[model samples]
Each structure stands twice: as structure tokens, then as C-alpha cells.
Target: MTNAEQPETPLDAVRALRAEFGIDAGRVDQIGRLLTGGDFRTVEEVVSLTGTSRRTVEAVFRALEPDLESSGDGRRVQEGRAAEYRCLFGAREPFGVRDPWTDDARRDPAAVAAMAGLIGAAPPPVQALDHVPATAETVVKRARFMLDGFDLTGAHVLFVGDHDLTSLGLFVAGGAPGLRASVVDVDERLLEFVGAEAARRGWDVRCHFADLRLGLPAALRESCELVFTDPPYTPEGVQLFVARGLQGLRDHRNGRVLLAYGFGERQPALGLAVQKALNPLHLAYEAMLPGFNRYAGAQAVGGAAALYVLRPTRRTAGAARAAADDTRTAMYTHGAQSVEASGGLDAQAAARVLELGADAGEKTLLVGDGWPADAPGRRIALPAFLGAPLPRNLQDHGTALVNLYPGFGASAVRALLAANAHRVGLVCRNDLPLLKDAEGQREFAGLVAPKFRIVRRLRDTPGPGQALVLAERAEPEGDAERVLGYMYARAHGKLGNAWREGLIAARKAAGTTLTKSEGRRAIEASASRPDLLERSLMELPLYLFAVLEGDVRRSVDALPG
Candidate 1:
């Protein structure tokens, strides 16, 4: 192709090269960028630097043979054509010479450069979650801004949703190695990816799973000092994420929430609506840097966003607590929760779900978003049902009619496990992907297994788009099993309360009369904290859940026989 017809960006070139040469174009791009990056990178250095396989690096060298040269120590683009190769390879300085917020003191050049190279390795945006990946430069700038503007030393930092990998960028931009950083995300893939990178790099970052629409992780509430978020570009999404961020702070008055938001230039009203929504939370606008964030995509808003520095007024504590968005599903602007995402249950759908549980002949308890105005049973929001502490009276729960869909997303597994009743039936769209295939069904069953024996009695039964999943509680089979059942049955109650009661009951049933005091002491000696005591069992991240499970089993075994 003529020079005029050539691709403008290296990513464009990578796409063309891959289509033409059937090569690992992504690695080729990275290798090319490294070779012309003003440094002689040895094959080994390139592999170490980019996490590109050694074999792939050598293959790229062979492909770029005509443009390459070598010295005794390393490789580079031939000096005479170095500049030409640099452009073709997409090599560019991470920080432009004209930028003002950046300085060596605030961010390390090498760390930021390395971060830029690795940023693309993150998983692509999942639209249902309203993910929009930011440019590496934007990510680095955000980190720099935080460091220059705040006292993050030994601070508990939170990334409300880190599909952009800003948590990694923070450390790259000089965050302390011991900085207590936590990332909460609904995507299991993202949590695993971020956790793996943190572990491999020894960055001291923790990843937890939570769909903010459901609720923030119980352990994270009121525990962090600074929160950074890039939420869905919708008013409800912005408000919900900011509210959750505010809730995470140890004291709202002293903490800050760094937000990235933007709207189309032609849609000023949309921006104003979001700003008005923030007013209710009583946050003071500390700073507004327009066009501060640049994205890799999201061109509808001009491929850029604004950075907002928000400080919580003391009154923000109450406002933030009261700001949970009831229309959870409608927050995401695309995919499952797109335009038709209201999640308002019609009389027919709600009644269908109720009919499945009607055989139980028990009182109904409504859980989650949207039930008809006249639907039976008292209400507990899905978020509260899944994560908040609830009454411990398991006997009072006759039949639980839950909403497992619409805005619910991946929390469906945990939601089903959270509801305790002899029979629980939930309403969701007919095409719920989890029950569509054999593999998904098997996986779903495995997760909630031993707790509930689930069966999908209806998928498209009521009409063109509807499904019903019914589960019955399983019988506890062992001492440990019984204790787990005891605790889980009252999943709405305080974890410590249920555990203590279950431990004491387990010992008594095993021919020993362990007192509540003894059970409590044993649990505390096991390193259980008051925060853990107040949390619901279903509210913990999976790792913490496993840890608590082990703790409870040990407590049961420790009880005198």
C-alpha cells in the first residue's frame, strides 16, 4: 500500500499485520515499540520487560530483520532509520514534554512506561458492566494527580471498579509498596486478572468481587481513606458509585473521592443532571479538571472525560448512606440492562414466581428489585438481602421469592445462596445465559450446591421471555455440615451470632454442652473481629468466606466432646 493509505496508529498496523502475516501481531507491536524505544533491549530484556514469550520475541526479530541492528549487548532499530522505525513501531514518550502536572518527584518515568506497555494486557471492556478502558497516559496522569493532591501514605485506598487498572497505575506512579490498596469489582475475570498482576509484581493490592448495585463488600464499608472510580457514564451509575465510595471512607469529612466522568458536548443537560444528583450527597467540588482523562474508546463523548476531586462534607455521611439507587438495573447504558432495563416486575411475572413457591404453603418474603405493587410478603431489597445484616429468625422465612435477574448480573449465584427458605423461587428473563447451556447449568449448580438443590422447572414457560429457578434447602449431613447449615440458614443475621450459636449447638448435639461464652471465646481466639461479627455470611468475598468456613469448622472441632 502507498504511504497515504498506510494505517495511522500502531494498533491499526498490528491489526493489518496480523491479518496479512498470521503473526502474533500484539507481541510484534510490543517488541517493535521496545526495539525503537531509545534503548537497546536485549531479546531477554524485551521478554522480561513485556512478559512476551522468548520464542515470540525471537520470531518478531526475524520478521523485522531488515529494520533491526545489533551490538554486543542488545538490539535496536538500525540507527539510520531509527526515527522511521520508531513511528512504525508506535514508540512514543509516555509523558509529553508540555504536560505540567507530571514531574520525576510525582511519578517515575520507568514505572509509568512499564505500566503503559502492560495496560493493554487488561481484558477488554465488558459493556454490560459499562466498562470503558482509559488510555495509559490518562491512567498515569490520574495516579500523578492523586499523589500530588493527597496524603496517601499508609492510606487505605479503594478502586471501586478497576477494569481500567488504575490501581496498578497508582503504584506505578509511586504509590508506596505497603499502601493498603483494595479493588472491588463484579467481574470475576477482572478480579482474578488484577489479583494475578498484583501478586506477580508484589504490589500489595487486594481484589474482591462485588456488584456495587448489590452492595459494597461488608468488610470494606467505612474502612478506606481514598476512593478512585470510573463508573458507567450514566447519572444513576455515577451517583451509585460515588455513594458507595463515600460509604467506604473511614470518615467522609477527611477523605476524597476522585471521579472520572464525561458527557457529550451536545448533551450539557445530561452532565447537569449528574451534577445535580451529586448535590444530594453533600460533596464539595474540590476541583474540576475538564478534558483531564483521555480514553482508548468512548468516542461519543469525544474520547475524553473530566477528572473530579470531591471532598465529602460531614453531612455527606447521611446523604451517602441514603443514596442507594433503587433502579439498579437501569444504571448500565448497554447490553443486558440497556434501554429496556427497568426491571419493574409486572403482575404476571411476579405471580408466576410466586406460584412456584405456593406449594410451600408458607408466608412470602420479597427480595431484590421490582415486585408488583400487590405482590405478597414483606420486602428486603436485593442489595440488603445479599450483603446487609438481616434478622436471624430463620423460622420466620417461610418462602422467599427473589429477583435473580435484570440488573442482578453475576451475583445470581451468591443471591440464591443468600436466601434461606425450604423453597425459594426467583424470576429472571427467559434467556438467562446461566441456565441456557449444560456447562453453565453445571457450574451454577456446583456453586450453590450442598446449600440448595436447584432445578429450572421453567425457561420460557410463561411466554416469549421469562424463566424460573427454584431451589430447596438440602439436609445437613455431618457435624460440620450441620453447623454450616445452622449459620447459613440464618444468613440474614450477624455472622458471629450465627457462628457462635451454631458452634454451641453443634457441641450440644454431639453430646457436649458448650456454653455461649465458651463458643464466643473460641471464635475470638480464632482471630474473629467485631467487624466480622456484624457482617452477614453471604456478604463476604469468596476468599473471606472460605476463611470463615475454615474458622467455623475449627471452632466446632475445638469444642469439648
Candidate 2:
């Protein structure tokens, strides 16, 4: 009888089918027994035996369906039978098996609405191909965290891989100010697509063709402050991709390498590996971008990625080690609080040397060159002869000479040390460049070696100059007593002018009714007394300096030179 017309028992039918399809004897007998017991009848019944859910069974059967009809008739099936509910394992197979993840046919409106109820929105069909767009909110949140954390203002950045959607989101979120972004990729098609989209959004996108398998392009050498990469995680390409990525960081100095590998439990190992690879370069690893898995699709391996911020490792040599040691001691002992509590002893030591003039008490020569008119009595203006020999006058004054200068230079530094080899107090700036050099060794040797007391003003507020107070030791020495008297006279003349100018301007600015002549007289009198000069200088800024100086004399009256 014809196969279609024949009627057969379940066991006989299953047995015959096994023989025709070359089924294994054991499986054939099992199938026969299942059908004989009424456990299976159609393809659906056979698929149910596999223990898969009904939907999966239906999808599998649908995938096995024929794509074309028999022959002369250009139709899949003749009209009437097409709608008939045929048995599974019948002549016709089911449909849509090729892509079970998505439906190929036009979605039924009712079905679409029903699915929407569950997911909040009908998902875009799988066939509706395009770049997966990340949510604007997600982009903004991630971008803000990156920008704020990395201080990305005015930084150059490179974006690698296909994160066009995320990149667009960053643009919308108003990424770092003055950031220049360059996008690199191997796929020209994707590049064109993203470039067009970026253009539409008014982004100044620079596209570069990069084949990472061959290592990073030469163009990437020390060019970027931040290199952002989002790489795929499949085993096929992951290893090679990561290797190249690590190589890309060689060009970075203080550059940060942001690698976005998807999230998962074992992700820490991957992060650790990346950290180890970059550790030699002194780069640090952190999770800069979180929550990356929401849109990467189910096939993506990891759920989140990490970013590495790198900085050049500082090298320590013998000199640096010594300097570091000294600074450590300074930090622990002579720091801000320590200096404040001690009332600036180191400064005081320097100041004492400047107060005692080079000569004992002979002709005291007072020098004031650009010494801020507002300095205190103990202050002096020494020349910028840091490397030069001490002046003859200074050598003659010796311990009694107080070299007062608003600031010190190389020439002044040398002269101070040589001229007053024993007793000169050198009053100089706290900002002397040599102070910051090699842990202030040059400055320390220059000012501290001569047994001269260095004194400096408390740098609590901004001002034009630094103040120092130096005192010469009262002792019997060769020509020392005479030099001490002369030093006091010089200090009187120089400090008198500084104290006068500072007090006058201060009082005038404070709206004090004191006339210029009156202010000058007051400054002159204050200079005669060091204690009064200090008080007046301090009071000037608070009550003077800010108010309008009305009816003030521009030039001081000629004093006996």
C-alpha cells in the first residue's frame, strides 16, 4: 500500500521508521515501546520525550519546515491545506527554526501588545539590525563619573572599538570640557556608520583605521592622555585583543588606560591579569565604567569592565634618597605647625645675621634696592650677588653687618656667606629657588653654615616681601664691638624707611585722616624702635592699605643722606 494510505499500529510504525532512517537498535526499540504505550504519537509527542519545554519544541519543529513547494506550482502549499492543523511528523515541517531567538514573520499586533505588557515595551525585532543604542541616562551617569574622577578637562582622549552608542551618550551628557576624542576601529563599515551618526549630532569625530591584531598603530605614541577601549570577551579574539591593548599603554606617560571588559564573577581575575601586565609601568587599575552589561546582549561574557589610570613611576637615586630622608624629617619636625609654634626659629636664625651689621660700629652703609616700602625694621635689601665675593664694606663690618634684602639671588647668597663668615645675618625670601632644590641643601648650607641665626616672618598672608629678624651675639671679638654699633645704625636707617612707607600707605588706605607728612613722621619714629615698627607694620594692612589715600604727598621730603 502507498505510505500515505497505509494504516499501521504504533509499534509497527515506529519500528519501520527506525529501519528507514538507520536509527540505532537500542533507540529504535525504546521509541517503539514509547509509541506502543501511547506515550508518543506525533513529532510534538516525540519532542516532549526529550523533556524540553513546549515552546522550545514548537520552535525546533518550526525550524525543520520546508522552504519551497513541490514543483510546477510556485506555492509552499496549496491554499486549503495550508491552514489545516496537520500532525507533527506529517508531510509538512514547521517554520522559523533558523533563528529561534527572533520571529521572522510580521509580528501579530495582538501578540506584540501582549509581549509589551511583560517587558514594558515591545523589543526591537532581532532582524531590525542596527547598533544597539545605550540609554542616555546610563551614558550620562557613566560619563560624569569618568570626567569627575579623572579630571578630564582639556585632555586628549582616544576611543577604541565599537562603543558608538556609548560615545554618543557621552556626547549628549556634555563630556569633559575641551576634550578631543578620536575613534579607532578595524571595521570600515562600522566606522562609516558611526561617523555619519556622530556628524549628525555635531561631533568632531576623527576616524582612524586600526588593526589591533598587529599591535597598536605608531600614531598612538604618547599622543593621548586617556585611551578608552571596549573589547569583545569571546575566547576566539579576547587573548589577542588584550595583548595588543596592553601594548598600547607603552606610549602613555601619565596616561590612563580604560578597558571595558564585560562583567561576571570571574572578572576579577581578568582585572588582576591586566593589573599585573600594567604594573611594570606603574599604572593603577579601577572600575571606572560600571553596569556595562545591560545592552551588550546575552552572548557577551562579562557583565562589567574596568579602567586603568597610569602614572610614571618616580625613580629614587642616591641623591633623591638622601633628599627624601631630609624632607621626611622636615615634615615630621619643622613643618607648618612646628614652625608656627616655635615662632619661626629657622627664620629667626637667618634674621639675626642680617640685623648685626658687617662692621662693629664704624660707618654703617644702609642699602635698599626694591625693598618693599612696607617691610619691617629688622628687614634689609641685599643685592642679588649669590655667587659673587662678599663686598669689601660687608667684610669689614663682618659679624656686625646685617644684609637686609627683600629677596636673595645667587650672587647675594655667595657674598653673605663670604663677607660675614662668622656673624652676618642674611635676611632673604622663603621663595629662594635654591630652597626647593635638593631638599634646600644649597639654601641651608648658604644660610645655616656660618653660625648666623636665620629669622623669617610668618607667611600667614599674601604680601610683597618676607620679613626676617637677625641679632648679632654680644661678645668680645676682633673689631666685633665696633661693627655691632655700626650695624645697629644701618639697621635703623634702612628699616626706618621700610617701616615708614608701610605704615603710611596702610594708614592712608584705611581712611585715616593722618596727612602724608604726619604718616612719614610716624613711620620714622616707629623705625627708631623695633617693637613699635612691628606693631605699626602689622596694623597698617588691617586699618590702612585698602581705603582711599586723600591729600597724600607723592614724594617724601629730602632727609639727610
Predicted structure with the largest lDDT when compared to the true one:
1
Cα-based lDDT for every prediction: 0.73, 0.36
Model 2 ranges off by over 4 Å = 1-136, 234-251, 266-282, 286-293, 299-561
lDDT tens digits, residue span 1-561, model 2? 498844354334433444544522333333223333322244334332322223332332332223213333212222333333122233322211222111211123333232223223213322111123232333444454456557667666666555434454445546667765666554544555555666666665545444343234434434566666555433323333333343444444455555554333323564455444334333344334333323323222221233333333343122222321221101111222121222222344433333443344443333333323332332223321221234554544333333333322222333333233344434444454434355654444433222233443322112234333343333323222222222222221232344345444444444544455664654353232232232211111111111112111121222111
Give the best candidate by TM-score. Answer: 1
Residue 44 local lDDT, model 1: 63
Worst ten in a row by lDDT for model 1: 91-100
Q: What value of lDDT does candidate 2 attain over all alpha carbons?
A: 0.36
Deviating ranges (above 4 Å) for candidate 1: 1-109, 113-121, 199-204, 325-327, 339-343, 369-376, 387-395, 430-433, 490-501, 513-536, 542-561
User: TM-score for every candidate vs. truth?
Assistant: 0.72, 0.30
Model 1 agreement with the true structure over 26-125: per-residue lDDT tens digits = 5466678887766777776765454444555666676566666778878777777667765665644321123455444235567667776767677777
In candidate 1, position 448 carries an lDDT of 64
